[model samples]
Target: MRMYYPYVNAYRQNTPNDHNGSNQVMTVLGNGSVSVQPDVANVELGVITENVSLLEAQQANATTMNQVIEALLRFGVPRENIQTTSYTVNPRYDFVDGEQIFKGYQVSNMITVEITAIDQIGSILDAAVESGANQVNSIQFTVQNSDTYEQQALQEALANAYDKANAIATSMQVNLNPIPFRIEERTDTMPIPFSKLALSAEAGATPIEPGQIVIRATLEVKFRY
Candidate 1:
């Protein structure tokens, strides 16, 4: 049987001129999407410190980062979920009379923390800041059970393709087959992180909103009718 993919010419262009079974074949593409609320979050926070010496700069950075990690642990974040992502120490220079002069040294240490609790995101960020986090970098929210959503979308896409095939078979006055040869195309959805959140005495908790996550599925179905 010949298949009629939308992007490919099944009868007029590719098949032989004497091909007579083209009327029995039908191809369809279906797209499906579902919206799901995020269940987990990953937040990156860090501390930046500057000192006259590299040792002092690194020491200060480590001290602040340790305090931040302790605070997160106290807030119920697991030790395994917290990881050091970046650490750097650089020399600060001052240009005077076109000469490079060393002024001080600056150190930066960053860690990524995974938060499973959906509702405590804001309060946790606030707590980290209180524990000496000065450079708040990024916060990302996503669904923990992505497999479930993707399966649901695939089912929906299959159903949509079947419906379209049925419609085409009916219009062509042919008997539709029960099963079709289907090719599934998978698409992954990315989480759009919330805008920057800064700490302030007046702002009670770091306001955060985890928007909906969308998953999509596509299928190419070929039916013999």
Candidate 2:
């Protein structure tokens, strides 16, 4: 009895055109993932203020934001790591009996802060809130750079493809030919899920845990036999 190549038939339609279109071409998918502790954390903090006048609202928001930035700086955060991400001023309105009424103006100022000192994350969050940060939009943990991890994943994926191709060829009693072409289906470093925190002085230091970040890559390999 001869072994039938079921895997080859499964992916026969997607075989590379440069190779033989018949049962000679086999396509296989290989995946690789690498996980490591996160090195940096990004936090988005915002200050919202409302007043009867637009100038007053904006001024109040700006003052609070300045205090927050100053606190972060005093905590050893670099100036370049602290940046204002967004600022907006909008009018507040109320609808009563199908009529629009102007209530007051609202100002929103948001900033993104990058922390390289992982151990200081909790302290930094506490300081920001104590200084006047009202809204904590999100906190994300990720690696500062992923080039090294990306290369490692690519190498692992390619090695996996090679081993799989050989194993299938031996099992089917066919001679595996050179690889004609391969495609990198996907490669990315994904950040951990972020959580929103309510900022208050009474809450004390915000506890932050930076977990591991996962880097993954997938490849489509075509082998001709």
Q: Which one is best on lDDT?
A: 2
Query: Residue 74's C-alpha lDDT in candidate 2?
Result: 96
Residue pairs with colliding backbones in model 2 are none
> Which portions of model 1 miss their true places by more than 4 Å?
1-26, 96-99, 167-178
CA RMSD of each candidate after superposition: 6.7, 7.7
Measured by C-alpha RMSD in angstroms, how accurate is candidate 1? 6.7
Model 2 scores a C-alpha lDDT of: 0.80
User: Against the hidden reference, what TM-scores do the models get?
Assistant: 0.79, 0.84
lDDT tens readout by residue for model 2, 1-225: 111222323222443444455456777767788997999989999899999988888888889989999999999999999888998888999999999999999999999999999999989989988989998988888886788997788667767776788799899987665453545456778898776787688887777878888898777777777
Error of 1 at 60 (Å): 0.6
